[model samples]
Target: MEKHSTLAQPDTLASAHRTFATEIAALQALDARLDDSFEQAVAMMLACQGRVVVTGIGKSGHIAKKIAATLASTGTPAFFMHGAEAIHGDLGMLTRQDIVLALSYSGAAHELLTVLSVVRRLGARLIALTGHAQSELARNADLHLDAHVAQEACPLNLAPTASTTAALVLGDALAVACLEARGFSREDFARSHPGGALGRRLLTRVRDVMRQGEALPIVHLDTPVADALVEMSTKGMGMTIVIDDNKQPAGIFTDGDLRRLIARHGDIRPLTVATGMTPGPKTIAPDALAVEAATVMDAGRLNQMLVVDDTGLLLGALHMHDLLAAKVI
Candidate 1:
């Protein structure tokens, strides 16, 4: 049988909570430590003529990679390089126009020192995220951000728990601040992340996926319910848009309406679309996002909607299946 620690489950839970509390306090310290230097760092990055190169080792390296990705997606162009690899031939990637962001919990990472020297020689400005403001990396940096924490969340204070969290949050702060400074919009982010769901939401317009031209099931308001049903059946969209003499949307008729009409009178053939159809049906513009169409369908308990122009002229129609096929669902 395996032996267990004397700590009970409640004690373990308490320890976990204390760990979270300690890290939260460390982040609070970092928040209070934000100063003019952070502004200067942002300015330096904004003025860079080329890409930002972020480098770190170990846990800091993981944080650096995420920071680089966030910066790239948000607006600023950046890439991550291992500090040790940077000292190798990767140093050739640096140029006079680039800026270096070096992350180190201890201000004296030996691997980073070699890279920092080359960066200085290359005329690239260096920004240091270090715990000690007076350490060698901080002293050499053109902009030094103090990422110091009072203690590690680790019980023994040996592992880099609280310290790494502070660094990661500080990096996120910088990325978001730069994003706002650049006036980057969702469209810009979508362009960067074209393969993701958010990209689909921002990049897809209603007209791109809506059934238009001959595919739209449209009929005159005076048309018989039988004729409307034929149009709906031919289009296979479960609905037909009823238009007035001016060629503008007057109303709509759907499969549900047909079933309800049968339930009420058992005779839909005698009715005209103008008398049996729903008046003033909900419609959407072609330039709107497909997600907005999904929202309307979900809210109104509808299966499809008519796409109209500003003057209420029918331009297209979209079914729930269309949205599902487009992955907008």
Candidate 2:
């Protein structure tokens, strides 16, 4: 039993190595398969006036969904339709202006054949991604992409393994190629993925989310500590900015400073903000990304920050909660 247990570990490791090796070889084969056909596919998608509808069945269906999402999020407008559902009225989603990209490893899923015929009759172009170029799905399509692999990673060679990986990588290749051909920018990607963290990092500017104007807790340097506390309380930012006569930041007093003041003196109400303010506080510009502001606050162990202009004048305020609300954190 102990000998068998010891051998099992090496057996599992060998299986993993074999799986990786097979998939890598399959991808290499796929890379070599890329030629003018790949370029033609990309050009067709680039010139598409409507969405690219991706459809497949079973495991291929999952990959189809992901490819559709990748295309949509990267500037190519696309959505997934189930191959099985196409005959059940989901075919209404296809139009003459649209292009259908169908995935079927066998090149002949009965469900896909029926859907492909209907899509063709609807005047939509078809791009077939299949392992068999001689198969019906590939033969009826306007474009055929051979996503064939030599063998499965499965030890039995019965499961869809390396073939699926090759199909997925090919889908990614098509999406990225189309993305580059269209000259899609990061901002364009952010627009499509507005609910994600990448969108927040790319699109959310400090000034767009900062509290400014009357919301600023600005007090003169000569303001008493008690009055500064009132301004901070009214603004609800846990801090107050002390401005010089030229409307520039002279110093800043925060809840931390108040705590130190209370610990050092029994009566801090009589002292001016100048006596307790921290001089030359860190500031950020309005045009900076909110994620950048979050980075500054985190590096300094700060909970709040002040926004400023080029001449050292205070413009607005930023709190950690603001970054949180903006999803920039």
At residue 31, what lDDT does model 2 achieve? 93
- lDDT scores for all predictions? 0.89, 0.91
Best by lDDT: 2
Listed in order, each prediction's TM-score against the native is 0.82, 0.84
**What would the C-alpha RMSD of candidate 2 be, to one decimal place?**
4.0
Q: Single out the weakest 10-residue window by summed lDDT for candidate 2.
A: 1-10
Task: Name the runs in model 2 displaced over 4 angstroms.
Answer: 1-10, 212-215, 233-236, 243-250, 255-269, 275-283, 296-303, 308-315, 324-327
Look at candidate 1 and tell me the lDDT of residue 233: 94
State the lDDT of candidate 1 residue by residue for 1-329, as single tens digits. 99989965568888999999999999988898799998988888888889989999999999999999988999998999998888878889888998899999898999898888898788888999999989999999988999999999998998999999998998898889899999999899999998899998888889989999888888897898888889999999998998888898888898887887788878777888777678888899999999999999899998988898897778899999999999877
Which tens-of-lDDT digit does each residue in 164-237 have in candidate 2?
Answer: 89999999999999998889998898888888889889999999899999988999999999999999999999
Off by over 4 Å in 1: 1-10, 185-199, 219-230, 243-250, 260-275, 295-301, 311-313, 324-329
